[model samples]
Target: MGGAALAAGGLLLPGTAQAAPRLTTPSPVALDLPTVPAPRSERTAGSALRPFGRHLAFGADPSQQVVVSWQVPDAVTAPFVRIGVQPGDFGAPVAAEVRTLVSKLSWQKPVEDQPPVKPTTVTQYYLHAQLDQLIPDTTYYYVVGHQGYDPAGQHTRLGDVASFRTAPAPGRGAGFTFTAFGDQGIGYNAAATGHLIAGLDPAFHLHMGDLSYANAGGSGKTSDAYDARLWDSFFVQNDPVASRTPWMPAIGNHEMEPWYGSDGYGGMRARFTTPDNAWSQSTGIYSWRYQNVGLISLDGNDVCYNTPANLDYTKGKQKKWLESRLAALRADSGIDFIVVYLHQCTYSTCHDNGAELGAQQDWAPLFDKYQVDLVLSGHNHVYERTDPIRAGKATRKVASGDTVNPVKDGTTYVVAGGGGGGLYSFPVSDTYLGHETGNDKPVPMVVSERGGHEQTVKVTWSRVRYTGYCLVAVDVTPGAAGKPARMEVRSLTEDGTAVDRVTVQRG
Candidate 1:
């Protein structure tokens, strides 16, 4: 650390003592501030229009740090954030830290596909602040937003105040709970998923992507054709659940740009703050370690298949980082296990349609080499469990000297795409897969096209892999790397009722 670092709320300033670090952001909406632009309707109804947070998500900045983020609504407006310890109310000097969203950014074309063009007319602003040096396992309360904004429908008095408990730090703890799911955008099913999560009250929530669905209640109009949809309005409707939880996320095609190039994941990216200076600094591809669990997120939006350049920039970099991360973890030998999270799937019942990534063939080897414990992903929608294996072959050898049963105690693949978007039809199709040989190595589990001699129409697994939603609760019992982390996978229905449960016992 440096003098500047120390000046950054770490300790006392040059003259006086420094207060504890506060992580907070100003309200997202500005009302009649006479500063920002007004909507065409300007239906600034109900004198008490209040601005509240829109997509509240949290990520562990270590047991000592917590990153909080939300959108600020308009570019012209700035955020007013505050933070403090729990068991105490916010706004109390003992608990509050305030900061201004005064940072500016000038974007250069990404190295991907670059072409100079006019700057975007509309810019999205994000509010970010970090709560640091916090005590572990303690509750923290926070509130965000302003008192008046048109769309909020009314003047806001008190912003929503939510509390969360910090996870125990490494070496100082043994176990904890957190929820992981993907594809549950916003809608009837998504709302139900949210309820289940709220009930669980895990330390944090990770959405595997596909979080939007059409009409149940959202601001956007035509979001319903699968991946893009959400409740009534994908953006607004999705806020209820997210506003209270520190929702960490993964990506899916739903987050991709309709145009496929410029500023993809537009609003979503702008609305969240990720570790910008850490390893894999790109928001889409970042890594954060919480307690004993280290999560690595990827951007499968690499877009092209088999091409060296594409692999080099996207998957290649990810693979290299994975290797480095694994090597470092192995050398340390202290963490309970290494868990990898991403949006694409390696094991699926949907089969070949998603085979273009060749993740099973390419990434499986790395997972095995590193002895990764669990690999969670979305995009397929439905849920799947893979027999532990190393690169298509089983871990044990058969009499004939062939790998038997393929997978083992070391690692298992999970397809958790189902998060409320679209559901895919199960059973893989061989005929449809014939086309994939160019990009995919056929897995025995995929369904074939020819069953009946007369009429052969195979019911291939479609988006189900990505559509089937569920929340996985991992109970990290005491152990070492490669050891099973007692896990309970729960699949709930549209009403938040538990429908399926799978328990993985430790070896």
Candidate 2:
């Protein structure tokens, strides 16, 4: 294999004798940026430490394990979490580990002769507590605090406590709901979406990627200004919903912070703890099974063409792991559905970012082979869905409210990018649940390819397109002895207006 192919984790062909090249992570970039302290407003007050940006994630097993993560503005002593089955009676204090991130700054000159960029250094402290051996299908109340600041203290208020429920045990045949979206940044719309998700009361949430746009530039190049504090605002904004629901996430191009690590995932690694059930060395790639549904989070940067900074960093291990995971999930009769989520679009018509051909070439075939039920993506800043597709072509047009059977038809792709980022436009007119712009002519759009080539192609699979801020809520009902499993997917705007709906079923 060629050097670029080998570097991107391509497998060697049979009868090839050349040894695989050794892969090494690039050393962190040193840009000599200035160091700054946490603003006075963010620091803790005299002995009263406050934790923000609280979120949750299921471990390898959702029924018996959960990882609780939260952030403190500044350094503190003896940080820990207290949890119990009752609201006011936490059993014992669970010590938490602190992950500290020192973020350096970089500036981008969009044009020549631009003035020098002034950047700020941001240091963040994140604490995590892993709770295991928990009862299934039960709600647990919890509070996060450090020395001299216990939320369970008699003087503390009721609002300080948050709760989360564990998923049902294996083969429980219990039904549940979950919400998903991507490209969510900190803003009024982002906060509104969070509230809408909270109202839905999903069992958990899937964040497709581009969580906090601290680095405004989506390009993997380190030339953009990096303001790490934007993460603080993002976490605080989503705290209401994330603190209560497991906020699972995939990594996107914007997540590639150049100054932190070789692939710019050091910050994300320190802030979130996801399931460690996939390739051991890969970040933002993991899988978990909750009742009858199997969820997989993939790192699109590994196979993206538009943003190739961390392209193929996995060395083919991620794809190999994905195939293996899919096979195992399919083998198990208990798993009735498989949903894969990533940042870049495998099939989208958004003129701004278009579709990622690398993903379409590398992963879509595996998706087809495994018969994945649903594929969710972001990075386009709009809501778009494709007809049930196989081999890059639409098998059939599935309108809003239509039901599809992946077992007979093909996998469905949804671009739920309207998760609070500014909207992007489609080459054609808008069409959604309540409104339809009767403009369905075939339009040419760009397809991002490896080596930075843009290919123009005309596509007809762009079925439902909504140019507004929205979130996707899915209700999963497990199949019984004589019945089939079903998932009802709904796209709702920021104000809880339904714009699109579809159903997927498997026998």
lDDT of each: 0.48, 0.82
Q: lDDT for model 2, on a 0 to 1 scale?
A: 0.82
Candidate 1 residues 1-507, lDDT tens each?
Answer: 001111211211221112222223334665534344344113233223233344444454556766555443332222334444642345522221222111111221222332343222322334445566877877776655432222212432244555556667666666766677777755577666677777776667777655553222221222313222121255455556565566777655455432212324333443455544224235466666666666766655443232112233353666676677767765554554567777666555564234323465457777888777777877666665454556554443111111112125446566766666656644543211112212232333442212211212222122112234566666556554876555554445445544344444444
Q: Give model 2's TM-score versus the native structure.
A: 0.88
Write down the lDDT that model 1 would get. 0.48
Using TM-score as the measure, the top candidate is 2
- Residues 283-349, model 2: lDDT tens digits: 7899888898988999999988888888888989889999999999999888999999999999998
Worst 10 residues of 2 by lDDT: 1-10
- Give the TM-scores of the predictions, in the order they appear: 0.66, 0.88
Looking at model 2, residue 343 earns an lDDT score of 94
Q: Give the winner by lDDT.
A: 2
Cα error of candidate 2 at position 86, Å: 0.7
What TM-score would candidate 1 get against the native? 0.66
Q: Give the range of the ten consecutive residues with the poorest summed lDDT in model 1.
A: 1-10
